[model samples]
Target chain A: MENSAIIQINQLIKRFPMGKGEFTALKGINLDFGTGEFAGLIGPSGSGKTTLLNIIGSLDMPTEGEAVVLGKPISKLSSKESAKLRKESLGFIFQSYNLLQVHTVFENVEFPLLLLDYTTAERKKMVMDALEWVGLTDKVKSKPPQLSGGECQRVAIARAMVKKPSLVLADEPTANLDAANSHNILQTMLNLNRELKTTFIFATHDEKVIGYLKRKIFLKDGLVDHEEWINQ
Target chain B: MKIAFKLAFRNLIGAGLRTWLNVIVLSFSFVVIIWMKGILVGWDHQAKNDMEQWEIGKGQFWHNQYDPYDGFTITDSHAPIPNEFKPEIEKGEMVPMLFAQGTIYPQGRMQPAMIKGIPANQTLLKIPTHKLDSVTDVIPAIIGEVMARSSHLEKGSRVVLRWRDSKGTFDAAEIEIVDIFSTTVPTIDVAQVWINLETMQEKLLLPEQATLFSFANAEENRPAVGDFRLKTKKELTAEIDAMIKTKSKGQSVFYFILLLLAMLAIFDTQILSIFRRQKEIGTYVALGYTRQQVVTLFTVEGAMHAVLAAALAAVYGIPFFIWQSKVGFTIPMDTSEFGMAIAPTMYPIYSVGLILSTTLIVLLTTSVVSYWPARRIAKMNPTEALRGKIQ
Candidate 1:
């Protein structure tokens, strides 16, 4: 993972203001995520998995040390540079199936391509292909509110995969679904990762998602407790 | 920016009732503001036209001592009609007018009146001076409806008219009301009577003398007449212009309140929408929009309300404005008392500039109003916003 790394983090630390005092969320973290790796940060509530994922997605900056993502130092990236990195290369899926409720499944999926300046026809094809990959082609016209939990997650997945981004950061992607829906969403993400060679990094402690990941980094008390490689 | 507009348009449409509710209120403002301004424009246009035909007649030459505001000057404002204007008056292109302070006793009720004299043969003014040509034993006079109503004199009614001559010799005579004319110009009407210029000159004992000369050839340049000042049509209508300007200023406060309400509706909607759509804003940022871009998107979305409102205004306002133009807006009250050239019913003039300026004003104002709240998004933290947290 280190040699083929698409993300390299060394001695990373993050802090939050806790009413005049500070709470350190990550303590001297060192990690590397190679291309095409289906990995996750496993932790309990408040274990800082989401914070770590957020930093890697360039949504936040590390308070100390270096986080180089796709060769751009996340700690030093300007707001615009970070936005450009996210727009061109990164995709995000959220726990609540953070699909734009008013948008149709197709529109939700096409959102990323709209930012990439794809032609309308190209966007249409790309969105359709991504929906097909998620087995949500039949639900293209349905809005997120009209879909089942599993269907909404798949739409979220399609949105994440539409641009074929180099990285997909999903935060507790299955936290709101039932067991069957959760497994279905994981299987879809797993298949997408394998076929597109896109790296998947999720922040979750769910067993269903943990079972599908080939690599897992366990966090306890804002520290990496251990890491294990499964099905390698 | 184009993509922002597109997205904003989609979002506004997607919001359904919320968007339309705001748009409808704004559209109402659009119609009303345009309509009110149009009425003022129409009134100005009509007043100028009426003054041109009934009173000013291209322009007037006023006696240097003649101030319409001062009654003391009326006794001395009279000057003998200049020799140079006599040819034009003979050509029926100019009319000499004389004014005198007089008293009329109709049905035993005394009323102070203005005695205005215009040549019976002149075609420059719309007054019924020709009716004065066939004067019988008594002098024939034309009075406006307001004067007739106030003086209680009707056509065929005989009244006593008394006035002082230039020599300060007071004289009295019997006069018959020949006609009671209806006109929009109060300057030519209210408590005033029109009689033959020759008859007025004879009664005032000022032969070949007049207070002013009204010329029909508005374009012809005139040489300086002895002690008389040339008043152009613009200067002549200055009173009406000033009145309309004052009315417009008074109405501006109403317009501001109207715009403020409409803008407040839009501004409130934008601020509320920005707060309610925190997750959506976060989603937008996550999907590659910088916070500033999201702000642009919200601002565009809000400003598009004006565009939508304009279209909505056109949908209903066009027919209303057209109907208003056809039927004219009627003042329920008599305009004769206003002492200005105001008609009972006034048509509105809607110019291209007015419509464009109004739309642009509403748009720019709405954009500014929308932008004020949208600036908050630039400072938002996408992570908290993603969770739909307020702070």
Candidate 2:
């Protein structure tokens, strides 16, 4: 494996129990993700993009073969060890902008660092900086219910990047946002990627997300068909 | 743990009216349980104190044949006063008494009574025995207010009293009521009459004799008097302790019911919270929480309701107790008919142990109720939860 490879998969297979049998989500597949790479697994629904992303993010494990994230095998890590990996080295953004509904915007953004056990002062500064990246520093006290869709997505972005983790995995992050809000959210993520040199992997079927990806891997029915690198 | 508490605290506070509703129910339980337990404790204390003061002194020695509950024993319950108690009796540290079955004719109505005899100047008891020294042509006798009312007699009212002597001869005399004392202890009152010890001995033709003796100082050494059996203060008040224990057992059912209601509210709230907050649980897992950590967070959130409830209880309970102290609780019905020493209006005493134990019980019950539903989080699939899917 290359020193720069933060995630590596070896003939990975994933299947979910379906009635008396099973349905394969990701057929035998292999992939690699290097440090500081801006990448996306692009395909339509049921094309295995999300299953692949979940494996890389350590939220799920391959049934056959290996998925090594940050040098820890996804299938072998204990529950505490996996949690530690997510806490210290990985972050996630969901499509629905799943901010803790009752918490203020600041508290939502501060959630990652809270798990990482940063000093209060350090956590406050980092959270502010992350919110500033998304231009949401002024809405610190507003809860999710009080915010617009665009603002809530920005808060989710701030939460994902607050700890400056080595990798961030976003699954259909723009699915619920309007085109304008989606573009703004993508721009903010792009700026964070360039500034901090953090690796970002997105599983998306939206063309708008595809336009921002530096590298796109297209999946066709649980198999990686091909990948294309764009010239920046 | 500290961070979990902070988050739990914020979450509970953020829940708004839903949070306060559960808290109010739990706090109400706190106040009511404490109040009920306090009443029983106060009753126990007051009942024992009254008995010690007006009825039994430090202790008593009953003649071998004496049985307070048996009327047949009263005829043979008398013996010459024990020699060992003579010095103490003279020193005012002890007093002797005797009682025999008798009948009274008051207002031309026949009534059975217990004719009790005590030293006119005895200081060992709260009974007004000195009133027997009153100068009157008729024998001066004292009765309790209950007896006075039932007999329709007043101070200076003369009534016919008849009783059998030690030799089995019957005699009758007119007795004047000199005093009508009031007391909480009914054992020494109700259908009873008191007169001078010497006067009773002369009338019975049996000098230097008494039924039982009560000592003022419990620490004084008592010698064995073959004719009498010694009873300690503890032995005499053991019944009160046993009675209080029985009352407490009955009160425990109320405690259980109160706790059950409060816990049901909390348990319902927690189930609803866990069901509705599936996305939040997913978000927590994605943000570096283990399934176990999420479980702990939810449990902490649930347990904190008790803490808040306790705070709310103190806000109202302290003042309520203080005000109640000023005006004691009035028994809704007459306590006299209970055949025990219960004041019509009794003051409740709250102790540190009672408050602390009650707080602990509520806290623990709430936590257990909270944790039961939170365990569901541990079995949830984080991948599905993030999408807010039903688990």
Candidate 3:
């Protein structure tokens, strides 16, 4: 593995119990992702894109192989260790923009930092900066229910990027957005990736998301079929 | 832990009426349990205090043969008053009483009764024994209200009294009722009559003899008299203690049921919260919380309802309890009908220990019920939960 590689997978297999039989979500697959890469796992639903992303994010473990994230084996990490990795190094974005509905936009962005031991003043400054990046400074006190779909997704992005984690796993981040909103979100993520050098791995089949990725790994039936790199 | 508290507080506050509804119900339990327990404590104190004042004067010494429960023993119960108690009696700290089996005919109806002779000038008990000092051709006597009602007799009414003297000879005389005293202690009130000690000693031809002696204060380390057994205040009130214990046991079941109703509301709310907040659970997991941490968060959230309820209870319960302590609680039924020392109106007594212990019990029970349902979060699949799937 190169020094720049932040995530490395070898013969990764993920299976779930279906009735009395086992259903393979991700077949034996090998993949590597380097730092500062804007990448997406492109495939239809149930093609193991999310399964693989979950494995890399340390939310789920590989069944038959090793998934190393930030030099920690995903399959071997204890629950506490996995939580620590997620808290300190990895960020996750969901398709539905899973902002804490009862919390203000500022509180949602401050969630990840609360897991760490940041001073209150440090957290406040960092949250304001992240919200400013997403152009949501005016909506800090607004709760998710009071915001539009586009604004909610922006808050989710601010929350994921608030800690300036080395890796961010976004799953179908644009699936619930309109075309204009999707473009706006993708452009913001792209600019953050270039400026902060933060590695982003997205599990999405949305063509609009695909058009903005620096590299695309096409997955077919739980296998990597092809890979493409786009010129900036 | 700090973050858990913070988030739990936010979640509880955010839930709005659902949270307050459970809190109010639990708060009602807190107030009622404390109030009910206070009434029992007050009754216990009142009953014991009344017995001390009206009947048992701190302690007593009984002649070995005297048994208050058996009327047959009264005929042989009297002896010459002990010389050791003479000084105390002269000092007005002790009073001697004599007892004998007797019969009364009121309105041509006959009834069995006990005739007691107490010093007319004694102040050891609340009874109006001075009424017996009336000088008249007919002997003056005092009886409790219950005895008066049973004999169809009233003040100033004359009744024929017959009794066996120490020599076993029957004597009869007409006695004038001097007074009818009301008392909570049935032992002092029911089926009894009182007369002047000097007059009774002369009538029975047993001068300077008494059946029992009551003292105004407990005397510790006193030498035992040869023919009498000393009874401390605690020993004298043992029956009342036993009765209160039995009553307290019955009361426990009521508070338990009351707590169960409140706990059911909290448990129901917790179960509903877990079902409805799956996505929030998932979001917490994705935000770097372990499943156990999420369980802790939910448990804390549920437990916080009790904290809020306690505050709410104090808001109203303090004033209500204070006012109750002053105004007292009146039993709807006649207390005299209960055939016990219960007063018609009982004032509740509140102690810090009682309030704190009750609060702790309810708080612990609420937390347990809350945690019982929240444990399910630890087994949830985060991936599915994030999608808002029912697990």
- Cα TM-score per model: 0.98, 0.96, 0.96
Chain A TM-score, each candidate: 0.97, 0.97, 0.98
lDDT of 3 by residue, B191-267 (tens): 88899998788888899999888898677545558687787889888888888889899989999998999999999
The DockQ-based CAPRI class assigned to model 3 is medium
User: DockQ for each candidate?
Assistant: 0.77, 0.82, 0.72
How is the predicted docking of candidate 1 categorized under the CAPRI scheme? medium
Tens-digit lDDT string for candidate 2 (B127-176) = 98878889999999999888888889998899999999989999999999
Model 1 misplaced regions, further than 4 Å: none
Positional deviation of A202 in candidate 3, in angstroms? 1.1
Using lDDT as the yardstick, the better of models 1 and 3 is: 1
What is the iRMSD of the candidate numbered 2? 0.9
Where does model 2 exceed 4 Å of error? A1-3, B220-223
lDDT of each: 0.91, 0.89, 0.90
DockQ of 1: 0.77
lDDT of 3 by residue, A67-184 (tens): 9999999999998998899999988888999888778999899999999999999999999999999999999999999999999999999999999999999999999999999999
TM-score of chain B of 1: 0.98
